[model samples]
Target: MGVFRFESKYAAPTKEQRERYMRGECEEHMFGNDGEIVLVLYDEAAYLKDDLEGVRILFTGASDKRKVDDEVRRLLEEHGQKEQRPDEFESGKRR
Candidate 1:
């Protein structure tokens, strides 16, 4: 019932990294530098069978938590996903 946040200067994870992630060998995969990537996880551990598919991408580009938070709000308004309260988590809420 906790949220995990991973920020990196990469665009997306690699195929091997994704496989490792699915195998629970790592918290997340960090590969590529096309832009920034912010991965948000709602589970306690990185053991999802979806292999990062279940994760959420807040945005792409470098920014502090504050700016990211604002972007997340904007994304919610623009393309609504599952219902969640912004105040539920310090960084972001679980879907």
Candidate 2:
């Protein structure tokens, strides 16, 4: 299994709060690999079912390890997000 990174302004249900989502009484949105949101509605059981709104299920894969930074930059560009300098000390600071 791959690590799925979630980035959304929307709030996520906590473990204790998941019951509402699991029961399909709440709505949630997840980001696709392409960075687009796939709207989903939860049932009383919160299990992703056929009733889940938006684009039903989306199959995704791991972000390219070598190209992840570049890809994120591209996405930011599309959204007019301000350019950020790469962390210059990150690699050197790691012990």
Ten residues in a row with the worst lDDT in model 1?
42-51
Candidate that would win on lDDT = 2
Candidate 2, run of 10 with poorest lDDT: 46-55
* lDDT for 95 (candidate 2): 55
lDDT of 2 at 67: 39
Q: Report the CA-based lDDT of candidate 1 relative to the real structure.
A: 0.34
TM-score of candidate 1 relative to the true fold: 0.23
Give lDDT per model, in order: 0.34, 0.35
lDDT over C-alpha atoms for residue 31 of model 2: 41
- In candidate 1, position 35 carries an lDDT of 16
What is the lDDT, from 0 to 100, of the residue 56 in candidate 2?
24
- Residues 29-88, model 1: lDDT tens digits: 332132122334322223111122233433222323235455444544533342343544
lDDT of residue 21 for candidate 1: 35
Candidate 2 local lDDT, 1-95, one digit each (tens):
12123343333445654442334445554443443533433332221212212222221223322333344344446434322555345655655
Error of 1 at 71 (Å): 0.6
What is the Cα root-mean-square deviation between model 1 and the actual structure?
Answer: 15.7
